[model samples]
Target: MNTNDSKLREQIAYFGRSMFERGLTAGSSGNISVRLDDGWLMTPTNCCLGNLDPADISRLTRSGVLVSGKAPSKEFFLHEAFLDRRPTDRAVVHLHSTYATAVSCLPDVDPRNVLPPLTPYSIMRFGKVALTPYHRPGDKRLGDEISIVAAEHRAVLLANHGPIVAAKDLESAVYAAEELEETAKLFLLLQGQRPRLLTPEQVAELERVFGEKEDDRAKTCC
Candidate 1:
C-alpha cells in the first residue's frame, strides 16, 4: 500500500480505539470505512473497534470484492451506500452509541428529521438526520433505504438500531457521530420539559453558512 492508504488505515484504527474507549461503541456493534480510489478500507466483521489491527483491516475492490486482510463488516452495505451516494464524503461511521440508539427507539420521533435543532454545531454537522425504518442488521436491503436519503442527509438513525454519520473525512464523521450522540442525550433529557430549541431562522442561517461551505468543499473534493 502507498503512504495515503497506510495513513488511512492507521487513522481508522486510532479513531476506532478512541470511540470504543469512550463508550461510543460496545463490543463489535460499530463499523467504520474510508473511501479509496480503487475500492475501500473497512473494519472487519465481528471485530471490536477498540482493538482494530491496522494491518488486518479489510481492503475491497471497487466492485466490493475482498482483496486482502479480514472480511469486511457485515454492515458493508451501509458504508458502501453512503460513500457511493455522498461523493464528497470520505468516510462513514456507524455506532450503536447508547443515547442515540435510545432516541432511535422512541416512537414519536419525526421520521424526516429526528434530532431537534438544539445546537448550531449539530445542525451544521448533520444537516438533518433522517430516521430510517427498522431493518435487520447486516441486511443488504438496508442499503436501499439508506440510498434513498443518502444524497440529502449527512446522517441517519436506523430505527431500533443506531446512528450513522457520513462526513468529508473519517475524523469529521467521528466527530459528527459524537455530536449526534450528545444531541440525542439532550433531546432525551428535555423530554417533558421546555428547552429553547434554535428557531427555524437560526437553523437556516447555519445551513446557509457552514452548510454551504461544506457544499463548496464537495465541489473541489475531486
Candidate 2:
C-alpha cells in the first residue's frame, strides 16, 4: 500500500504483461520476482503472467515466509536460491521462451557456451550463460544446481525447461532474458552451418571490460 510497493506492483504487472504479449511465456507457465527492501514481490502461484493484477502479487519475507495472500509460485526455490547465493541481485525472471527452450533440449548445446557471441548486446548483457541439466518443474534440486553456477553466470538455461536470468533490476533482468532467447534463436538458425563466432581475443576483451565491473560487485552469484 506504500508508495514504493505500489510502484513495484505496477512494474511487475507491466513486465508480466509484456512477457505474455511477447510470447516469452504461455499459459500459466512463468514466474517473476523482484527484490524489495523488505522482501520480494513475486507473481501469485498459478497466475498467468498475461492476466496478473498488480495487487494480486505475492509478498514474501526474507526468511521465505509468505507475508501476503495467494501462495507463492511452486518454483519459488529458483528465485529464493539465487537471492541466497547473491545478495546483490535485485530481480529474477524465468521464462519458457520458445527458442531458448528448444536449444536447451539439444544434446549438442554446450553449457559453457550456451549462447554464441552473435551480437554485442548479448555479450554485454549476459557474459556466459551456464546450462543447467533438466529437473522437474518446482524441483528444489534445480535451485541447488543453479546455486553452484550462479556465482559465475548472469543467465542460465534450464535444460528441457527454459532460461532464467538475474540482474540488478527488473528491467535489466527482463532484457537479459529476452536476449538469451534471441541468442538461442540465432544459434538454432545457424545450426548445421558453421557460423562466425567471436574470436577468443574479442571474447577475452569483453570479459576484461565487463568482468572488472562484475567482479567488484559484492562477489555476486547468478
| Top candidate by TM-score | 1
Against the unseen true structure, what C-alpha lDDT does each candidate score?
A: 0.89, 0.84
Error of 1 at 140 (Å): 1.6
Q: Write candidate 2's Cα lDDT for 124-172 as tens digits.
A: 6777888998889878899999998898887888999988899888887
Each candidate structure's TM-score, on Cα atoms with residue i matched to residue i, is 0.95, 0.92
lDDT of 1 by residue, 1-222 (tens): 789888999999999999999999999889999988889999999999999999999999977899988999989888888878999888999999999999999997788888889887788667688989888887877899899899989899999999999998887888889989999999999999989989999998877777768745333322
- The local lDDT score (0 to 100) that residue 8 gets in candidate 2 is 88
User: How many residue pairs clash per model?
Assistant: 0, 1
Q: Please report the TM-score between candidate 2 and the true structure.
A: 0.92
| Candidate 2, lDDT over the whole model | 0.84
lDDT of 1 at 155: 91
